[model samples]
Target: MFKKLSVLAITFVLLLGCLPMLSAQAAGNATAKQPGNSNPLMDHKLGADPFALTYNGRVYIYMSSDAYVYNSNGTVKDNDFSALNKINVISSADMVNWTDHGAIPVAGANNVNGSAGIAKWASLSWAPSAAVKKINGQDKFFLYFANGASGIGVLTANSPIGPWSDPLGKALVTGSTPGMSGVTWLFDPAVLVDDDGSGYLYAGGGIPNTSDPASIASPKTARVLRLGADMTSIVGSASTIDAPYMFEDSGIHKYGGKYYYSYCFNFSGTHPAAYPAGEIGYMVSNSPMGPFTYTGHFLKNPYTFFGVGGNNHHAVFNFNNQWYVVYHAQTVAKAVLGDGKGYRSPHINKLVHNSNGTIQEVQGDMAGIAQIANLNPYTRVEAETIGWNAGITTERTQAAGGPVSNMNVTNINNGDWVAVGNADFGSSGASSFKANVASATGGGKIEIRLDSATGPLVGTLNVPNTGGAQSWQEVQTTVSNAAGVHRLYLVFTGSGSGNLFNFDYWQFSTGGDGGTTPPPVSKVEAEDMTLSGTYAGKITSPFSGVALYGNDDAAAFNQYYAYGTHNFSVRGASNNSSTARVDLLIGGVNVGSFNFSGTTPSVQTLTNVAHATGNQEVKLVVTTDNGSWDAYVDYIEWSQ
Candidate 1:
């Protein structure tokens, strides 16, 4: 999927009749591979060579941006891999709904930052592999990408979806690197951080040129090298692996105390019964740097699953204790353009391991894996976290004082909307809704709906002119009859044409009196609370003027309110530790807790907490010390 192919124009025009049939199918139908059906992940854009990274409770996927090329006459041209210079990042706690983090400007002249890429010397970036390692008490992320099959470049960031930078300012692996001799096309890197805190890198693909044709069966073209303690440098020279019928895409994973070295078999010559052409084959070994034995093929070519075959690229990883494989196909492009023209989009399917340590054959199709967890609507959710979307696009922009960059739902017009799946609004239901929005032009209305885009209308938020597009304002509206687990939709409505407004994030409030009055949800900013403990202090961020951060730190809020069961939620960041947690105490009695993780600030809730009426004290105490003990708390909300 990383390489380019030439397609005839006549063949493309002849396949135009398939679009009508595809469009006629219902979205929820099993045969349809649309956004709601969960096949190609997303249909708005194209991406390929998907690599997965699991941190905390989320799975982040890094992909090579697959923008469609065009002929001079404005017809779609074949994907030539020349326009690929950026990497797309998207993540989800639930596998079905994903949050688009936009693209990382990796190479070439015009990056997303308006200058040269993070790696200015590289011209192309493709087939990215991402890994996270703990260094100097904090998590450091490393991204290895192919610089057009000639070399591999590395970028480092503090977060998975990064504001990345090239630490070395050049390619990390080149043909000149030691032990790279006899290696053809030194790219397609797969990295592993072993359980022992050691790192290993696997790369190098393509068949060797020789007079003896049998060399195709054992190319010996793949290389394995030990990564230094810093994970940016090499420990020693590289070592070669004799992968049978190896072509491209070097994949590695450790399971059942054994190292699995997998690759895509080459299509150049005749293959044996054991090795299949253009399919993924694996070899097993006891060590990361291995004298390995060839196993069996698990995944067939994309043609077997989607009927549109090209080169296959894949990554295997474990998320939420379940094994899954992410690969690319031309399904989305073929449905829209009638012919795929070698353009590709990413897809995921479940992978199973037999008790004997052998992998079960994977079945790849339009139906993807089930959602591992339900989404919490009571917290602030990014508008880009979409299960399905229509007539809209996302862009990376800087909020007034937020992170370096944040993605927002944009390019919205009338009849456009975004949907989120399996949102648990609880038995009490939601009473109100809030959104962070902005607009330079006349603003529009956001209709909160259930199930489908045109489903039941629960509430509506009228957006106003916010001075500028980056100027954000929090707006709220009363909600009614929004309860239980169901798909949530934010439908945009407006007058005139072009983009109406930009949506950053949204949250819904529960436990209000079902009436015309607004929900009785009370929010207390962290900085305004009384702080105690040795390390507790206030910090500043874009979302809040002051936020609380510390280990074993406690913040107390004393207020007079009605005695009843209420939902308690907090907005915060985990300081890059999965074990971060905060205990909620009402009048000095522990009621429930809120868990935090990942670098991005999000909201987590502890619902149905009993509070006594009259003046009472509520406290939040950080209980975990695994990370830097620098976890943050932006605000706490109580809704009844």
Candidate 2:
């Protein structure tokens, strides 16, 4: 009996020892986000009502900012959308790694630009839509948003990630607008710029007010209107789009010369076999101002895929010759809070358009679409571009003399790291790495790793105090054994610290050869190079020894070794009253151009110019003639 009791006691102790392991297994099962999953785009913040814009080989997603709301007891409350006065923006070139461009303070009492909002007249902003049109040979971006359920407002900017401003200082659409008398909710705008450059705006949703069942079945509340040439103004009165079971969330896309109008199906009444409640349904029309025919639904409700039900919102776009749809789900919130609480995060999946003009039904899941392209690590990559990360946040700040407001990775502590997916270091491998960084306190070390955060260590860059957090400087470190395509991880480490450093952008060098030695930082004097054309001449300058000056002249530097992408800086000046242009060519291929106006000789640097390997002929050609006055060149520097 004593032996049996001892055996039982031992078994009990062993079972007690296994409790934490079983509990950990249960916690791991509850984690909605998994390693290598591309869904939700980012885990640092929550965003909803995703709209995508493709420009210059990148896809930019604009979303309504969804933040946590807390109860009086310090627990998370259901999302009320009261703090949704800002719109978040993120972009990706390869789809797997997304760069957080920060948020646009659209409407609020205080904002990034100033105390007043970008659109100060509007109290709330939600469900944003973005469109870019070339006006007067320059691209102009327009952002449209819902001002609660009452009206719609528009903001304009010079770039997609904007420091935007209200053009009219008022709402664009309201109850009094012509032909909008029946719209139950005048919001959720979607804009499309057709192939012919004509722009159309699709807005409005909600069931009709009549008690007739037909009204609920076919609520003719959605509206489409012609946008003016400027895209900021309405060209004509809105027209009705009689969509069946219309709830909200209007989406528009053109495929195979046919217009598709998609919206959420209303859940108020019994949905027909053809229409399911909370799913995304669509209609087809030949014209933008549509007398449409109801088509089939392409996307089901979130509950159908994620096991969590909520309102449906989406945007369909063609990026890199492939169709994709970005939508919002409560997966992240549910994973954290055990219940979603209505907080949302954006997700993306492949969208297919069948050959017959019908869109293939999209199956939304945690596994997203494969990356279409590999990221080039040779060029300057924004530090905020992340595939996965832990213990980090991003903030908006301006890079020194940068044209637009930029975002930097911040709030980094020990063990924090950011990863970039599928970074192609090429066959030559990388010899060195550099980053624009700043630190207010004692700085930390950046551990350059490959594959995973704990993977092979390639190099380490020690960051130093740069006086202030915004006072930036370029720091470099030698890299070795980093080649081919791998997930690049920037792991942070330091002694006693709360925060370490702020990172802006980083680049890798290939030494202009396959060698592991760091590339020489040198300049090729333009005056010493071979010159041609009618006005080619050499002159003496105080800034630089001998300078090359000419109009319609070309200076050639032979046997110049260049690899990957490098910062090309030209020290020159132009006395022309108008802007003078100089073209840079490598191996007869035009890489880029530089424009200068004033006579003051200063350095003009162009970052991230792609170059081919081996020895090549580099040329500086004065393509633009500024009267008899010529553009002067002192020397041309690369990778300095």
Backbone atom clashes (below 3 Å) for every candidate: 2, 0
lDDT of 1 by residue, 1-640 (tens): 3342221231121111001101212222222245456777766566788889987556788888756667999887866665677788888767888888778889854453358478888887878999998766457899999887788889999988877989998888889888888887787899999987799999988766533467787788899989998888888899889898887889999999999998887776677878887789899999999988888989988888988877778899997567999888888777767767777777899999888888888899987976655677776678888877776677776665333457888877877788887787778888988888999889999999998877899999999989888888888888999988888988888994677899998888764532334346899988899988887877775355233356557988898854334678888876664646777777675666676676688899865444444677988888644554556788999774
**Residue 89 C-alpha lDDT in model 2:** 88
Full-model lDDT for every candidate: 0.76, 0.76
- Clashes counted in candidate 1 amount to 2
lDDT of 2: 0.76
Candidate 2 residue lDDT tens string, 1-640: 0001122222111000000000111211214445577887877677788899986456889888656767999887766555767788888867778888877878853453367478877777778999987665346899999887778899999878877889988888898888889887788899999977799888887665535678888888889988888887787699998888887889999888899999987766577888987789889999978887998999987878987766788999986567889988878777767776676778899998888888889999998877656677876688988887777778876566432568888877778888888787877788889899999989999999998878999999999999889889888888999998898989888774676889898878887332335445578887788988876777775354233355558888876443445678888877545555677887776666666666777788876554554788888888544342367788888862
Which whole-number lDDT from 0 to 100 does residue 185 have in model 1? 76
Looking at model 1, which ten-residue stretch has the lowest summed lDDT?
A: 13-22
* Candidate with maximal lDDT: 1
Say what the RMSD of model 1 is: 8.9
TM-score of each: 0.78, 0.77
Clashing residue pairs, backbone N/CA/C < 3 A, model 2: none
Q: What is the overall TM-score of model 2 with all chains considered together?
A: 0.77
